[model samples]
Target: MVHAETVAGRRTGSPWLPFAVRRLLGLVAIFVALLVVSFLIVQLIPGDPAAGLAGADADLADIARVRHQLGLDQPLGQRFSDYVGGVLSGDLGTSFMYRQPVLTIIDNRLPFTATIALSAITIVLLVAIPLGMLIGVLTQGGRRRWLDTGFGFVTGLLDSVPGYVMATFLVVMFALGIGLLPLFPPAYTPRFGSASFVLPVAAIVIGPICTVSRVVRRETAVVLGNDYLRTARGWRLPAWKRYVKWALPNLLTSTLTVSGLVLTGLIGGAVVIESVFALPGLGSGIIKAILDRDYPVIQAMVIVIGMIAALINLLVDILLGLIDERTLGGSHVST
Candidate 1:
């Protein structure tokens, strides 16, 4: 009893489910490809595995014996198979330099790193969205050019400053210069009630918040300039409600994408900031691994960081699609 017009409308309206399913599958395949590529890239780095394991003075016979024991004599295909199997089984192989299981190293350090990343992201989103919205709304009146100019300058300055510089300046001013806190504590006990993590979290948040706020401000300005928003304003609706209903939804979709990029930037930035503050996060672990050339630790850290970045971007895209059906449906029709 369904007419052709009804069927066509249904098809257009319900296209999102199939499109979303395809995007999800694409995300999974990309992550799998990253894992395989990471394994191969790490294996390709030139080095004497035995020398990396044992000291340079280790006897040739002992080195050969160690290589044989570690299955370095196997073909590349077999090694790759073993690597994939081990990864699937939650075994990241032994660290030639650290002489411990790679999973143990990652497992021990994951909580601290996750906490820092989560805290930094929370700070960025919580602070940036409102600030950007305010700036965007005010600048729309043509009376706040100075404010907009000042905000732009400050954002650019913060974005240009590296995380380490900001961290160091904070440490000098807050800890050494003011003597209000300890000079970059060495151990992080990770107690929720403790005051230990406050400064470090603040340091990570500063650059990201400023950067995210700038992106949001720019995007919100563009969104507010759209004809729909202008039409809403002409309707004499309540100013705040008009912005909330019309401006924020569009701004936030774009902001979520910027937030993902900030999260990606956080991976590298956190390493330095965490190290400078001596937080026992994955960042510190990466620094130590580099100093010691712990191959498994380094590779595992890279894989974790890369996966996190990719996953955040994927989630952001999904969020954008879900929040704005117009975009999703439009893209589906075009495809």
Candidate 2:
């Protein structure tokens, strides 16, 4: 016999449907807001895009002609309407500096940024998860207060350092001081085989590792305190089976949610890290565009970053719903 709660849950559609729809709507709203804010901010920046395109030595008449040609002579409302329409139609327009389509420039540069971001995330998960699990297990039972305190202190210290500062430190220690690696090479590209990728990935990984580990440790500690965990311990089950098969699954639902946020932050961090490492990625491209006041490139980059972040959050939400039935608005069933 189906319960009333079950019927209500069914009537609401797939348990995750409402949540997914809400999140999707929110994501669209955020993207729209970003577009408006980016457009307005670019307009407020000094120097005319038309003038910039016309060249410094070009006289007023030449600038005016360039503006008219670029449709900048239109009323602000019409120009913004066109800009928003272009965004909706997936036409980010052309780059004033490169004379190439903005999407083309982004496509060319995306792989490098993606490689760095993925590498950093890989390193973070590989190192942080195991280390955090170990710390959580060892520091359980509240008997070893010092161990927990020490771990917290270390992670806190690491998190306190900014990405740029950490990048500089890594460069000084590994690249310049020890003379161990090349700082810069002519026409460099980031590939998996290159030794040059290390410092930037390392710098990007540091804070995330610290932050993720702390979250995992806290969650693990909480899972350890659960009544079922106590019962499992009383039953004399092997430590590995108890923690790995049982405790870890519960910890992951929470840990992964935090990891999604961390991953999004890594995208922003990539900009600074790429610049510091002098990598030819979107981050460096963004810096150059900002200096040149290249509106199309800047707006496109912001939107791309927002989309990536929103997708990550969506995936994380779905995963959480799958892992914990209660999160899908269903009753939790204990096996």
Candidate 3:
């Protein structure tokens, strides 16, 4: 009979299964750590949840009663155990300010946050990838030094600007200065196909485009300089054909890795951009929850965002494994 280890050593059914299981375990560990840290950090914030619940003018007795009612009077160890257990059981607790379930609040705001994140990623990939490839190809050919310098300078400038600052500038330029679009209406109520999405999406895309393009350009340059690509050139292949058929496929591994990071950054950046645009998203909700010392809402948002980042990275890993079999513990497959 064949042993399991021998079967694993040979190019058997699916090498990816073991790697995927390991990655899943790692993700679960990260999620647990995130919850513990989030809970502890929120607890460390300097404020009384009881007071927030009871109001400033409330009598001492009222505050005491509120504390007891919310289980704030419980021992720290007990409270933590309860919190972790509740999270594992799909009970995120109720929002202190909204007096509603934390899950319900998140469910309502999730679509808006998701829309912004997704739209920004779509814009980044569509715009940055081609632009970066073109720039890389041009620079590799030793043409357009001035154009490369200009692009480098602009991307550098954009990288330095924060999301809110960029959002403000876009609003000033397009909405206020040009009188081209209505900023308030869209900021207040952003719709998928509406014009209001323009400014917000632009703001979210700016930094990522600069960052991802630079990475893609560098990677593309490296791919273009490879010996095989030189061999392809020795055959007198057309430039476009070489790039499309040879350079791009080789460049995808690195570009895809960078895309995962860009996706995570976009999610984080959306919080600030969403606030600046006055968009009704998790970012604004998180801000309000913090100011109000609403621990449930804050904890829930942190968990959701952390999960998103983890999932994106995980998906990128799986895709990388598929593209390059060596990543799944097998021999490298030729491109």
Candidate 4:
């Protein structure tokens, strides 16, 4: 989820260089580990990819040629080395099923996924955080206990519902019954600006917002009880000034951490939403690759998603450290 910047006592510590470098190295290790797992998973699958490519009627010669073309004929160690080298050099190889470069396929499909994910994240933060703030304030009076209880009940229900189920409900309400929007007809070219895109994006957003708002509400309530906040109230400060100058800075860290988790979850959870909406995005690409047994696309997608998630989490950590000098013990701020 995305968040608006709030005024805070300037963040302290050199959190950028060291934290980012460490995160990059960690991401490299994760990539290498994921590569090994991917290779083994494919190797252990019931059927041979080479034979799968060449049909049941094909002769040994055809299978051999297919194996050689796919580099399966090489010794396992040699193939592993080549795989690692190719990955390091950004040559993830071509897709046997798509008959296209893996990079090309990713380039063609990534934007739609990015757009949907970004929009969902933005929407979640827009709705969830403010609602959380409201919940936090209400809880202070002890007058709206049901408000939190009601929100908790609704969030639990939403989280329990499958993403596709939610997407279908939205489609039925907006597209079928009311005819207020198009039903995402097959082969439809996805455009972010289209009126039809809202429902699908909203489908992705609702579950995450419900989850995040709960956390934000709890954290904000805690932060409101901090010493600085208590002191601000003791001084009889204006409400708006107190929230802006004291309460928000302390609460920013919670927002960053929650947003990082939400973004990471979106990468994996977007598949059902993407398929339901017929959007040509990374989630759909992954489903297509799995059905076709396109190893290259699967491998590349896994690595890319892992890296993006790692980078976002690392950014959150660094920002947290920068935002609160106590997080760094005592140091100059990083750019």
**Cα misplacement distance, residue 156 of candidate 2 (Å):** 0.5
Residues 212-312 of candidate 2 have per-residue lDDT tens digits of: 99999999999999999999999999999999999988998889888989988999999999899877788998888888988889888878877877887
Using Cα atoms with residue i matched to residue i, what is each candidate's TM-score against the true structure? Answer: 0.85, 0.90, 0.90, 0.86
Task: Give Cα-based local distance difference scores for all models.
Answer: 0.76, 0.86, 0.85, 0.78
Q: Which is the leading candidate under TM-score?
A: 3
Instruction: Summarize candidate 3's per-residue lDDT along 1-335 as a digit string, tens digits.
Output: 45765656655456677787788898989898988987897887888989978987999899999999888899989988999999999999998887899999998888888888888888898888888998998898667889889889999999889888989999999998998876646435446756777888888898999988988888888998899999989999998889988887777788888899988988899899879977778988888888888988999899998888898888888888877766667342221
Tens digits of per-residue lDDT for model 1, 190-303: 654245556677777888788888888888788888998788889888888878877888788778877878877887787888788877678898778766656567767777
Model 4 ranges off by over 4 Å: 1-17, 185-190, 328-335
lDDT of 1 at 179: 75
Best of the two (2, 4) by TM-score: 2
lDDT of 4 by residue, 218-309 (tens): 87788887888888899999987776667767777878777789877887778778888777878888888777777788888877777767
RMSD of each: 3.4, 3.3, 4.1, 6.6
Ranked by lDDT, top first: 2, 3, 4, 1
Measured with C-alpha atoms, the lDDT of residue 222 in candidate 1 is: 89
Q: Which 10-residue span in candidate 4 carries the lowest summed lDDT?
A: 1-10
lDDT of 4 at 4: 23
